[model samples]
Target: MIVFQQRYPVAFTIAACLVCGSAVAQSAIEHHVWQDKRKFEPYSRTAKSITGAIRLSGNPDFATPGSKMTMTFGNGKKVGLTSVGASWRQWDETDDKKATAEAFKLSRDPGHLRNGNTLCGDPQSDPAQYVVFLERSTFGDSTRLLGMAVFGSKEVPHDINSQSLCGTFSYSTD
Candidate 1:
């Protein structure tokens, strides 16, 4: 029989392997909207708001022991633009976004979204999006995300389980 330490070089190796396996076998994405804001009239003084959170369970095959498993957003293909911003580029990549929390604050700033007249198109309509990234690693790093906890700007009850009228959410597994 092999000793416990001798059997498993790293105490958490088994747990980490199991976690990575689960992600590979059944990866999933859950986007929960906690707040949302929109406006049909750009010139309007105020705008509707929507906020939400996203959870991802992904497994990147062939990842090394010390490699990283980060969740990054794809760049826009059309117009040769690669970015996750609300600009003149097509809206393809604008839908699926991920970035550091600090980057998302640019949109959540009350004053920024309030300036609806600076819309890309359709002066009568304005849309804004704010998404934050959550990273996981194969090196036994864990992120304790208990679903998304978005705060509603309205005075309504803080029903975390309730869905908001935010953008569409899609879930897929590999």
Candidate 2:
């Protein structure tokens, strides 16, 4: 009976290893350069663009905050983005489940005053706030929406803090 029990555990261990190995083999990694556009209202202040790069891993999960990212513009300008917040949305046949990985406010040294309050909504909400969406793609890397709202302390007429898609993007596992 002792020998049978020992063999059973060994078999279980082998089976577990095989399952985990298969999952790792099926997973993949990719990077994407994305272009986004944002248009504001009233005065028709239109067409602001930003180019960004994202590195994505398989299993359709969202990336964690502080996962190094960079953005470039049309005139050969570039900036590194420090991800302050991230939320993952899992889609089923009927509904979606959202999970927040990090919750914090973003503040640029010069302040992002292009399209006020367009990307991220009210900042007063507890646990922070995020908008997540899943886009159709042949590549495993999906589209993620991120933003925040900045209230002017005393000066400025509450300009919207935002970034939009612009320029070409490439995807690769390497």
Residues 1-174 of candidate 2 have per-residue lDDT tens digits of: 567658798887788799999987854553211212221111111213222222222212234455433333223333344444343433211223432332222232221224442222233332112212222232255533332222222222111222221111222212
Write the residue-wise lDDT of candidate 1 on 1-174 in tens digits: 248657775865777788988888854533222111211111111111211212222323221222222221111111111112122211222223332211121122222222232212232243222322222111243422211112222222122222321232221211
TM-score of each: 0.18, 0.29
- Residue 112 in candidate 2, Cα distance off native in Å: 12
Q: Give the candidate number with the greatest TM-score.
A: 2
Candidate 1: residue 93 lDDT (0-100): 21
Q: Once model 1 is optimally superposed onto the true structure by TM-score, how far is the C-alpha of residue 107 displaced, in angstroms?
A: 4.3
State the RMSD for candidate 1.
16.3
